[model samples]
Target: MHPPDAPGTEPCDWSWETAADPDEVHALLTACDAHQATASGTPAPRRRPETTRWLVESGSVHLLRHTTGPAGMFTLTARPPSGTDESVFPPAEHPLYLSRLAVAPAWLAGGALVGLRCVRQAVETAAGLGGDTLRAQVNPDLRDTCSLLDLLGFTPCGPASADETGRRHAHLHRPLTAPAADRRGD
Candidate 1:
């Protein structure tokens, strides 16, 4: 069974489950695509179902859904790298990789609290998965991405990757509370 939805005064429930297939992954991505389009002034990319299906068969990708609201579903998914450690936390001790973190807009205005809670939850999930630091390549194309991250305790540093492509993305990171040295990248 999944955990309860965020504590909203109005009260709605949210569930979390492992997305077992790529088709399910696509549904989440497609929603993310829609969200990116709505949040940004650009059109969401058309995700080819074939590629999405291929990812599912690859065996490292998984999805989580948060259901219980006008708009429900996980809004977050991670495609773990190949040869990961399922025996351990995070299943794959992927030191660094990409996580398709997304939140629907409908849940924004009426549910900022819920959304923020999920962000924190994501951080906790990453930590529980034995992650040293949670890294996200925030698309700078969306100006507010950095600000939102900043509010959530993430900071931007190290080599940035914006100039190579029209879409700039800075590697923003939030570290765990273990060895303080790990947080300080030299």
Candidate 2:
């Protein structure tokens, strides 16, 4: 379920489902990669066909849509993506991993609201699933993402580590408690 819009943004609808269709997932990720490439001045990496299939098969993929259309997406899973170093995360009873988060370029202009909402959703979902902690490995270059994770109470688990792709990511985590509404007094 999509949460309500923040105080000053357009009315948007956030919806999610377990991704069953690879085509949809591929398209969204492609758009996000192109946007990131433009912003970062690096060419977008070509993704393998198996990557989309892995994303769909490996975890629960959630797609966020606004009244305008698909706005963002994320994945939650018990296992980290293939190259992630497991030692970076802090100990927890049950950890749910958050990965592959992306917001369309159009929605990014509205600030980090979309990304914030996605993290909040992950928190709620993780807690509901009996997860004691929510963990994520994010590219350090994405300043907006790093900032949002920090603002929402996620702390760095350890030093940044480079994946096989040679990109450095800072591992972050937050312990789960009550739902976001209760904790924030919403």
Which numbered prediction scores highest in lDDT against the true structure?
A: 2
Compose the digit string of candidate 2's lDDT tens values, residues 107-170: 7765546777778888888889999899888777777778889999899877886655665678
lDDT of each: 0.53, 0.76
User: Which TM-score value belongs to model 2?
Assistant: 0.80
lDDT of 2 at 64: 75
- Which candidate number has the best TM-score? 2
- C-alpha TM-score for every candidate: 0.61, 0.80
Candidate 1, poorest ten consecutive residues by summed lDDT = 83-92
Clashes of each: 5, 0
lDDT of 1: 0.53
Estimate, for each residue in 1-186, the C-alpha lDDT of model 1 and write its tens digit: 222343453333445444456666776668866876677765565457876666556543434344442222232235433322322332223443434555545455343444455566667676777766665666666665556678988776555454332444556667655565665864
